[model samples]
Target: MSASETNSFRAGRIVQLLFGIAVAAAFMLPIVWLVAGSFRPGSEIFTSLDPLSIGTFIPPRPTLANFGSALGGAFRTGLINSIVVAACTVVVGLLVCAAAAFALSAMQWRGREVVFAIIVFSFLIPEEVVALPLSAIFAQGGLQNTYTALIVPFVGNGIVIFLMRQFFLAIPRSLIEAAQVDGAGWLRIFLQIFLPLSRPALIAAGVILFNAQWQAYLWPLLVTTRADMLLAPITLGLMVGEHTSDYGQIFAASTILSFIPAVVLLGFQRFFTDSVAMSGVKE
Candidate 1:
């Protein structure tokens, strides 16, 4: 290539790199402030209301008082509630979604495609549309403020079923056939073979669902009226308004609430990426 072309290419790449960094900084700045703000002593945090100000983002002294206060208050109750709800949702939801996917993908049946298509179509239906009805039903049945109100509704996630089904479709039919030839029933084949092979996809889906459930605010708020029944999102949100100009406690709670998903995603990131990419591949 000509010198001009080389210079042009280098210049373009440099511009792109700078642009990317700028965009990334724009996003990271807020998070930096949030974390930094949490560590700042109460006096330092309130010196200026400007979120991006150096004084607000960087404190001369850092302390853990905010974290301790938050942990002792709403953060404690909310964190426990979130963990319980997310864990149960992952376990039961994964089981039901994976099994449904297996039946849809590996089994010989009529209208399986139609059924799956209907599910796929249901994806377009927003959860908000059904939230009111579900709330009313729960209220009428006296299930409000109960664990059933939180965990039962999410066990049959359509998107999860679709993802698992797509992944299963890429599995070799010969393996399934061989299992059947060896007198392995569908359940045995599924549990022993399919489940083991599909661990990556299972974990990926579980992590996604767990994060969603953990961060859920609206539905949980609507279902339960009790103060102690709060989850992180609602608790942290309320904390923002409770203490006037107390950024430390709010940021501390936000950090704690965000920690779980960050650790989970970091740990399973490789598996999650592989599962998502492989789900698109065909046999």
Candidate 2:
């Protein structure tokens, strides 16, 4: 290429980099403000709010009191509850969804399409539309105010099944056929061949599912009325809003709560990214 063309190319690349950085900063500004505000004194949070102020960038007098309160106060219990619920949701959702996806993808049963359609249709039904009926069912089943109420209702996640099915469908049919030819039952074929190969899809589904369960608010609030039963992390952060409007504490707790999912996402980011990339590569 000519010298002028090369220089122009470099300049264009630099401009693109700058534009990308600016877009990223724009997206991250709210989170940056939250973290910064959390460190600031409550008085300074609302009054002296300049997101980019270097003077306010670092906490003037950093205190762990907000974190302390968050850990020891209502947040502590709520955080615990959230952990329990989210853990249960992730484990149970993965198991149930995986089994359902396997069956849908591998088997040829009567009315299979109809069943899959119904499950997908459930996703279209807004949570708010079903909340009232679900609450009543929980009340009748004596699951109200219990962990069962929180975990059981969401165990069979349609979206998880859908994603898993899509991934399973992409697997080589020869592997499944070979397993079957070797006298392997459906269970053995799924366990030895399908499950092992579907790690990427599982990881991707897990990350999405965990995030959903972690941040869940409305259903938990409806079912568990007792403070002791409150889930940790998100629930606790929310309770901070109700008990005391301490913005600093709220921000601190929220910032801390935010990190849990981000950390979780980051931990599996490579796997999730690889899964997406691999999905695009033709078999």
Candidate 3:
């Protein structure tokens, strides 16, 4: 390459790197502020308006009192509840969605397209629009104030089923035919053949479902009135506002709660990414 061309290419690379770093810093600024504020004194959270100002990146003295208060107070109960509810939702959702996806993809049942269409169409109905009627049903069914109230309604998500079905559809028909020739029953084929091949879809679905249920606020708040029945992290962080506007404790609880999903994602991120990539590979 000519000298001018080489210099131009180098300049382009520098510009791209600079732009990427600027965007990354922009996104990280809020998280940085939140972490820094969590360490600051309760009184200083709002008082120190310019946390990123010169020489203010680090606090003078960081204390764990906010974390202590958050854990000691109602925040703790809320966090536990959130975990339980989210776990239940994830388990139930995965099982139901996987089963439905398997049937739709692997079986030669009649009216399958119509059934799948109905499932997809249900996604158009907003949750808020149905909350009132759902609440009434929960009350009538004696599910109110119970963990069932938080979990049952979310057991079958349309998006999850659709995604799983799409993934399952991509699996080669030859694989299923081979399994059938081996005298594998539908259940056996699903468990041994389809499930193994559909791991990426499963992981993708699990991550999305888990995150959705983890951060769920409106449904839980509406269904359960009692504080003791509330879910984990989110509930705890929310109650922080009700109990008192303790920004320090609130930020601390939020920071800790935020880490739960982050930790989960970090642990399984590789699997999730690989699965997504494999899903795009045509058989």
- The most accurate candidate by lDDT is 1
Name the 10 consecutive residues with the lowest summed lDDT in model 3: 233-242
Residue runs of model 3 more than 4 Å from their true location after superposition: 49-51, 54-56, 237-244
lDDT of all predictions: 0.85, 0.81, 0.82
User: Model 3, range 1-283, lDDT digits (tens) per residue?
Assistant: 9999999999999999999999999998888777777787777876755756843456679888888888897788888887888788888898899999999987998999999999999988888888888898898998888998998878898989998887887788888899889898988988888887777678778877888888777788778878799776446546545456888887888888888998888877887677656656666
Clashes of each: 0, 9, 8
Candidate 2 accuracy as lDDT: 0.81
TM-score of 3: 0.91
Error of 1 at 125 (Å): 1.7
Q: For model 1, how does the per-residue alpha-carbon lDDT over 117-205 read when each residue is reduced to its tens digit? A: 99898878887888889899999999988888999888888888888998898888999999989999999989999999998899888
Candidate that beats the other on lDDT, 2 or 3, i.e. the better one? 3
lDDT ranking of the models: 1, 3, 2
Instruction: Give the Å error, residue 233, model 3.
Output: 5.8
Candidate 2, residues 1-283, lDDT tens digits: the string is 9999999999999999999999999998788778887777777777755757765656677777777766778887787777788888888888889999999988889999999999999988888888888888898988888989988877888888888887888887788788888899999988888888889888888887888888777777778877788776445446545555788778787887889999999899888777666655545
